[model samples]
Target chain A: MTPLRHVFFVSDGTGITAETLGHTLLTQFEAVEFKTTTLPFVNSPEKARSTLDFINFIAKDAGLRPLIFSTTVNDEVRAILRTADALFLDLFDLMIHTIELELGVASTHAQGRAHGMANQQKYNSRISAMNYAMEHDDGQSTRDLARADVILIAPSRCGKTPTSLYLALQHGLFATNFPLTEDDLEQQKLPSSLRGLENKCFGLTSEPERLSQIRSERRPGSKYASLAQCAYELRQAEQLYRRAQVPFLNSANMSIEEIATMVMQEKNLRKPTF
Target chain B: MTPLRHVFFVSDGTGITAETLGHTLLTQFEAVEFKTTTLPFVNSPEKARSTLDFINFIAKDAGLRPLIFSTTVNDEVRAILRTADALFLDLFDLMIHTIELELGVASTHAQGRAHGMANQQKYNSRISAMNYAMEHDDGQSTRDLARADVILIAPSRCGKTPTSLYLALQHGLFATNFPLTEDDLEQQKLPSSLRGLENKCFGLTSEPERLSQIRSERRPGSKYASLAQCAYELRQAEQLYRRAQVPFLNSANMSIEEIATMVMQEKNLRKPTF
Candidate 1:
């Protein structure tokens, strides 16, 4: 068994930048076992001291020096964190310096600016998109299907809701998902409400075995979770895609982020350019 | 005013990692103007060539070498991206290699693995959390507030929804949010559904000016969106927080990411440990 290593993502604010960059780097090293924790909003010397203590404790417990990925922008807070008995890595210093030199400007060294609230318009649009994604999820509100940037069509548990929500959160895209019911699959047609909006549609299809496994978690031992049913639904849905000339992708192997962005790229070509 | 420079977040998958890291880096250079675009799922050599073309076009139009921050893991795709008429930086290679040596393992060099479907449990939990957040949004369903990891309370448009969703999507945290309505503010008490769930409650307060500005966009010129109304609501909400002893953050300056993580850190201290 691979030795379990404790990893910490430390930041002065959300810790998202640290976590995302750290996780991406960590994903490459598949042989090691990494149990990760995030310590966010560590703005003060006191908080940094406690975080350092936490890292030390975890390192001692695991008999390994914890790997601390930090983006503590504050110099004073960062000084306290540097005292931990671990292999510390600063995520921002070197890159920010290079960018600073390129632009011939000094950085503000402010906290929470990475994802802070400055532009009200961008923020409001993101919230509105989130509400829109939920309101129209699973074919609930097809009334304003025309207004959606992209309408995701997929069978139950085929990753429509999460993908739609991801698009809304990340891109501020008004993405709505419609689940293809068994009847629609059997009829080999899109839903009545989505008929005219076919141009703004994207389809998500997945493997039968994967679909079966996903469905089993929700409705154990039911026909809905059966392999045969999933195969039938996926086949019929793909046929509908081909007939309607709508582009689709297999989402069984894809993440919500992957599917959301890929859908947008496809949609971008067909939809009007901004 | 600073001259506009074209910026590109190029990635082999969702482009989220590139966009996020690039955005964080850009935030430090506050004085610069960056017109950024994301090029996602550029896995194929042809796609890479086309992305380079887009970068070149932006450079030609803007008369400045575009800054391209890429997380393209594929070597061939990366080579094509590097050939663009711009300054290019790889986001993951050096760090992943250093860690790979530390672990004495080779990287998979897989595309989409950063946010891919390697862990089924984590993916399902994220979806479950999204559903929980949606159901519990604005006190819509509070029958099982006990199940939530954190219940965010705030006045309308104070950013509870986006923060809740971001936590769910990123952390797989079951975060529910409730709007501290005018009725609750006037009564100066927690809502009936949230009374016993005080332990799980976290509050969000914002600057009255920012609140008014946010509200005015949604309900232009209405009394609810007026400065007096915003001031009164924020004052009452803060008093309620003091009475309930609920920990709160002024979200006027923080981003949704910052607010979510800070709320989690506060909730982490009070909630049970794993």
Candidate 2:
């Protein structure tokens, strides 16, 4: 195996986009091996000094050269990253250049101001709408909930939280979900909040055996981890959804991306431009 | 403003990849207005019939021809999509051809299997390994946490789930996260589950004001949504992280793509090639 190269993500704020682009670019080169670690929201000179010290330690090892992808809000931090020996991809530089070329606007060099063209008013309004919906939700909000762009109703352990976040982050959709409790199954009703918004909701079900296996790994000996309970929950959740007119998807066979996209498309939601 | 053109995304399975690529491409064009919708996981002729009906509804009053980016798994579904009088980009054709050429694999006429990669064994193993970690984890699992490809720890209402999924789906990293709860905060401890994994643990925090604002939208009137409580949580979580030597990112300002990329670089994770 090729030795792993250590890469550092130095950020002015959150270093998410740089890391994503960097990761994808790394995939293009199969000959080199890499191991990554991130330092996010690094906005201080002292932090930069410590980061440099860490880089120096890695450099002393001789085998690994640190690669840094930094997102910075401050010029001083950027300057610090620039003086480092690692290969640094500074997003502030890229965004400033791109913005200058695209819109003919000189960058202000002010902190926290950079690239991206989304209309803040519209984006904020959309988010506010979801916030309002979430706040107003009742217990019925838990079922075939229509106020959400995508509603993920799954039993415990079925990856609901991650899937919702993926949809929100990647697609910029207002995705929400609720866990399908036994009460929901016992009542054979979607939580009351979902009554009017049934068409907008989706379900995520996993194989009972798979869920039981997963639960067993966690709790080991609890009644909650029993295969029989898992089967019951799975069957009852499906029945409730079917009666409620909420379409469901099996998460067992799908990745989070697939689930998020499917729900986004089903609701005529716009995918995130970024 | 130009009237929005009807845009459709038809996919064989979940329509996630098609929508992802289509939306990214759409972002490149600002001159045209688009009204987008998707038909997901349409793998059978019956489903194709419904998709066509939906297409007709969208196109009935089209002054300009609609545009479609379709990834079809079924030949019959592809044929149906071809009959629509829209400017369509057949994505399945493009990607399958690209993959086959890159991997030297013969393309098969299989339904609902457009992106079933030839290296299934390797991909499956990676997924299983990550899933296993998720299950075995108990608010604690200290095994070489520092050795993790990427570690994500975010408080409730921050966009951890979406970011983690994007990292996993697009980049193929074994990413796992745990919530930063009140208990973890009061104790000033990284979950006992994450105790020794300090080097591997990355915290995701947001401005308490921003987080409270976010949570209030979801659960108004509850203590969980109180700005004061949120601020306290944010402060305590950061303090705990500092004491525990865990690095963290703020989620308020970053997009999901940015967060995923940031994590990928921090962990020195890899993306799949073929």
True contacts kept of each: 0.68, 0.07
Against the reference, the lDDT scores of all candidates come to 0.82, 0.62
Off by over 4 Å in 2: A1-208, A220-227, A233-274, B45-57, B95-104, B111-198, B201-253, B271-274
lDDT of 1 at B108: 79
Candidate maximizing lDDT: 1
Q: What is the per-residue lDDT of model 1 for residues A8-40, given as tens digits with 9 covering 90 to 100?
A: 888887778888888877776777788888887
The weakest ten consecutive residues by lDDT in model 1 chain A span A265-274
Question: What local lDDT score does residue A173 receive in model 2, on the 0 to 100 scale?
Answer: 59
Local error of candidate 2 at residue B77 (angstroms): 3.4
Give model 2's TM-score versus the native structure: 0.55
Clashing pairs in 1: none
Output the lDDT of residue B245, model 1: 93
Kindly list the per-residue Cα lDDT of model 2 for residues B57-140, writing each as its tens digit: 777877666777776756688888888767666644544444334323455555444333324465455554445344323234
What TM-score fits each model?
A: 0.87, 0.55
For candidate 2 chain A, which ten residues in a row score worst on lDDT? A109-118
Provide all candidates' interface root-mean-square deviations: 4.0, 9.2
